[model samples]
Target: MNSESLVKPCSYDPSFKVDIRSHEPLWCCAMTSSDVLVEMSALLSQLESICRKENEPSSQVSQQTGGKRKRHYSNTFQNHGMVLIERMTNLLQKTMSPVPTLLEYLESNSCAILFPRAVLYVKNPTAKHTPIKRAPMDGYFSQATALNQLISLCHQLQHDVTTMTNHKYIAHQIALLYQSINQLGNPKVLLDHRTSIETTFKKIKAELEKEGEKAPCLNSELIFWLQNLTSSLVQSVKTLSAELTSQMRPAMKYILQSTT
Candidate 1:
């Protein structure tokens, strides 16, 4: 099944209680309690065996001796890990108690989901920022959602500055992105250096545009100055993006490895 399909709709109550029966109900296939326990036990045992094999000292002995594992073995291990991850995630969805719904669990681990999307946006600059279009802007649902939007806008701002000739238009979009980021707030506790950059950006835009009004066209000198300004702004956004990712990565790693 598609991964997107696996994410069931979560209904919320005003009192902040989860209707667990409705959340991911499809996963609760009719089965006797004993049968479910047996199946879960077997799957857990198999997963443990695979993990043990992967973690064995002998496995690292090859690497320590400057010898790589055989290609087939490496592929097999990776496939096993993927299968186990899917199974475990499914099991968690199926078995979660109302005390902590899957949505709650996922929200607590929002950084896990956010960091990967952030990395994809940063590492692949040319890739389409698909999540940004549908991301929640309210900033209350999840930090991950807002970060997705911010990252996409940051990329768009960079692209616009580099490819668009209209400095005013690019600056306007940059201002919008900055405002969105500020409204989103820093849930990940990233060191905020954006205030100074944002101030500089506004000052530069105001000064440059005022000066440009005196000239009939954006001359070579003005163009050079605009290019430098755009470059600096892009760099500032990129720096913040990287710092936020770095702050969340450790938590993300823990969440990814979670079996419960």
Candidate 2:
């Protein structure tokens, strides 16, 4: 899908929690989960196995506090996660032939679903600053969503890397990706970017630093998710800007070097 036809879901606003389930919103077309089944069942099964193994066996209890305090499986689940990941790799290779590269889409291929009939205006011919239109937007957004599903694949991949291989390299790559998301997709970017999404983003980062000082412990994975997405998204503004500028370049310079 190209630019104009990208789906921009109403959820992107992040206003009061929206309940769009009754019917698909104006921007998004109708979709049933089974319609786009790309064969992820095998990988899901591997993940479930990992979860089961991570749980404390009924017999293997440790004596603590007074008796064995049931230790909830948190990060421990993935600590022993490798063999399953290899299986996931096999699933990816075997299934999903000629899959669309992007996971986010509107109808069939969108990640950020747009509101139906919502118009996003643009000023350029080659492209516009406007958001996705109905048709193409759905494709891109769907592709984006599909890409996101692969995160489970990646989690498995990382788990696999944990075994036999030194995890430092893989861990660092994962860390960087997560970090990029934070640096780019800051919440401020969503609300009132024209007023400085960059500044708002910096403020959010600063707050995180401060919070880290008080309660150093945080759901690092979720945080990683937030920041990683944030960083990657920062580039989007630049991309959009370039598209607009390039498309309007000739028209913009029409009056320049005029002999009149």
Largest TM-score belongs to which candidate? 1
Q: Tell me which residue pairs clash in candidate 1.
A: none
Report how far off residue 197 is in candidate 1 (Å): 3.2
Candidate 2 ranges beyond 4 A from true positions: 1-139, 142-154, 179-184, 187-260
Q: Residue-wise lDDT of candidate 2 within 76-148, one digit each (tens)? A: 4443333333333333333245533222212232212222211111011122122222322223333334334
List lDDT for all candidates, in order.
0.47, 0.35
Quote model 1's TM-score: 0.33
Top model number, lDDT? 1
Q: For residues 125-241, could you state the per-residue lDDT of candidate 1 as single tens digits?
A: 334333332211112234454566666666675565556666556556656766766755552332243554455565546644775364323445544544554455445445545
Candidate 2: global Cα-lDDT? 0.35
lDDT of 2 at 139: 37
